[model samples]
Target: MIERKITYQHSFIGQQFIAKLDFTSQYHSLYCARLKSLKYRCISADESGYFSLSEIMEVKVNQSCLIAGIIVCTYADRSSIVEKYISKIGILADRKQSTFYNRRKEEDFIYLEDESGRVRLDLKQYFDWENLITGLVVAVRGVMRENSVLEVIEIFYPSADPPRPLLRKGDEFICFISGIEIGNPSLDPILLNLLSNFLQGNLGNDSAEVAKNIVRFVILGNSLYKADKENSFEQKAYSDISADIVPSISKSLEFFDTFLAELAGILPVDLIPGEMDPSNSSMPQQPLNPYLFPLASRYSALRSFPNPYECKIDGIHILCTSGQNINAIMQFIDTQDPIKILELTMKWRHLAPNAPDALGCIPMQDDDPFIVEDLPNLYVVGGMPNYQKLVTEEGVHCITIPKFTSRQQVVLVNRFTMESETLSFVSVIQGMNNC
Candidate 1:
């Protein structure tokens, strides 16, 4: 890691690109934005991270007051409360896996706190704590009770935008496809046939015209599939693995290169690396080494990017990740809904809070890359089996572009309105041919 002094420059009209801190403070601006958007009253936000102590003191004991703060669990902090009143108190917690065969009942003992102080919450009276998770921000109007806890009366979360209309779409569109596994000789011929037909306008209808309007095609990651020679004798020997590399060319790699060169020749192709590629399995994973991609190298339209990447295309701020964060949080949590999880992560305004918890990631020194303080116009993630999209309340496009290996689905996002349409090459080609 390199350490360099940061130079700050003053500018009035334009915004500056900067890093974000995820440990805390990333969601403060959102909390404030939410407060203002909802027209909620704040008595004192001196320490805007949570409700201030001064404000709490102003409320006479036994009187009701509005409280806002980050949620915490007192299960690990208070032994007396846990032992004496464990039956009476319910802790907001997730099922933590202590060992492969053992599941531990852990509690975050939901409390609210800021830099000033901490206040325990009793949501039993009004709100169901079942939906609450650690690190969620909330506002609750409640009466003060003994033992420094709040007796819940009302609870609130920021509003989510209504579902978008299907007709509302962006002006220009970009295509996103991932997990092509390009070089594997065992690649499905029907998959290529469908894509080639679409690209070549063999579909013979409005579908072909729609494909023509696609501004660019993004091969989101995992471009290089393992060579067919992986099972060779040299590959089996630890020291002689490089000997198997003697072939210099395998059926999969050659086919993948040819396909990339053809695609890059037609439209701008952005190649990102996945875990299978020669790159680290961490956030900001390295780009595909161009030396290995000869056919793609010949085309000037081809470009490479890190796993989690950001770029501007067609006046749109686009951010993408290879689905590391969502995969991490999904492991311990029981939820199977990817879109719901994506919405929650965006609501929290951080990319992946559970990184390095169960997910493998490259640790950042000071500023965490996952904290998304300033949102992008369109956010895309790959490495899933089905396409999903939602326009967040903040007007940001949240898209989950599915893996191309199984379903052969691709996402088309309108650049202007940020709406998305999922296209299945297999289904489209089959339908068109049968028609």
Candidate 2:
């Protein structure tokens, strides 16, 4: 059934399409998950890390004081702006230029940008510790030099006490599994059976209890593998289709529909689209066409959401995206470790800050919705090459939910404590054997 069609004539961020989303206002990211606005603050050293920086700017030129602001390079493109200044802290320029302005010689300058404007930074003494991650809001104590540079100073990161949510009397659980890859032969068969049994079929004892407590299951992305082995569109033209059977998305949907219908029969499921799915190629992908899932559609519990999904369940704030954000970040960052990058990115308050540079996201020219106004209780990235989870020192649970085709492990989070545990179906079966 076809309804009104909203057109996305342009790929830019500010483009307006009279669709389900509101482009005029503050847009949510990864597929917007609007929630109640909570109280948060950016602070300085003297005041509690809870006081706003705007309320506490006390430093003057030649006097030593602490100030807080977002870090930015003068140039728009971060790649061209070399960190050559890492070695030397040169004198500040008289007037800030949109392009590169030589302070001493070839020494690049870094600026602390805030509500007022930009102030050139001289970090020769603290260059080593300034392992400054772009987009992080931090406080620095230094002498504002006559030459316009903020001389070598001490850095301060704002801190906050983790918000504790009151849990219900009954223990609850939510499962997160990514890269479903339905109908793909590469998927582990044992994992499938274990899931079916523990989730919908008969699984006695502790397992059944776990299944019942699992209130919601989020399928991050890649529900269908577009191209799999045994399918050769190049070899099998119009005639060769008879001999060699090619993989079909329709067939994949058939498998997904059965799975969703079965799973939705027992519990609610949220499906997100990956690059391989028939959704928009850009970030903030729209929900999949419901028409494809005729069987699953029969159940009110089954629904499809956009990638980078966000929502709150029982007061727990959760945000997730199919691995695109992680992939883009790893390419720009020095390390391949996902946990390290995710931990740092959370502080920046934006999921993909380096987007439109190294990453391929729709450039939202007007306003960036990717900016995380409030931190989530749990953050998940699907389709990771491996499985990993870390309850960050800051108290946010960062998790990488892996693809089902490779690893059968799905993440299980305690609905009350927000604590996470990785569960591998094969291991569970083997453990059952021992019991």
Top candidate, metric TM-score: 2
My TM-score estimates for the predictions, one after another, are 0.63, 0.66
Clash totals in order: 6, 4
Residue-by-residue lDDT tens digits, candidate 1, 1-435: 111121222111111112222333344443333323332322322223344323444555687777665555333422342443443344533233321111233554567654456777777786356444444555667888877788777665533333223443445567888877765555566687677557655566776677667767787776656554453211132223356554543555676777778777666677777655656654556666687778789887787777677776534567777776666555434355777668767665556654443344454443445555456777788887688888777767789988787667888887667778888777665775798
C-alpha-based local distance difference test score of model 1: 0.59
TM-score of candidate 2 relative to the true fold? 0.66
- For model 2 the local lDDT of residue 355 reads 55
Off by over 4 Å in 2: 1-124, 127-131, 136-152, 155-162, 166-169, 183-185, 203-206, 226-247, 427-435
Question: Per-model C-alpha lDDT, please?
Answer: 0.59, 0.61
Q: Candidate 2 residues 35-93, lDDT tens each? A: 11111234423453432333123456687656666555443333232332432244432
Clashes of 1: 6
Model 2 clash tally, residue pairs? 4
lDDT computed for candidate 2: 0.61
Best by lDDT: 2
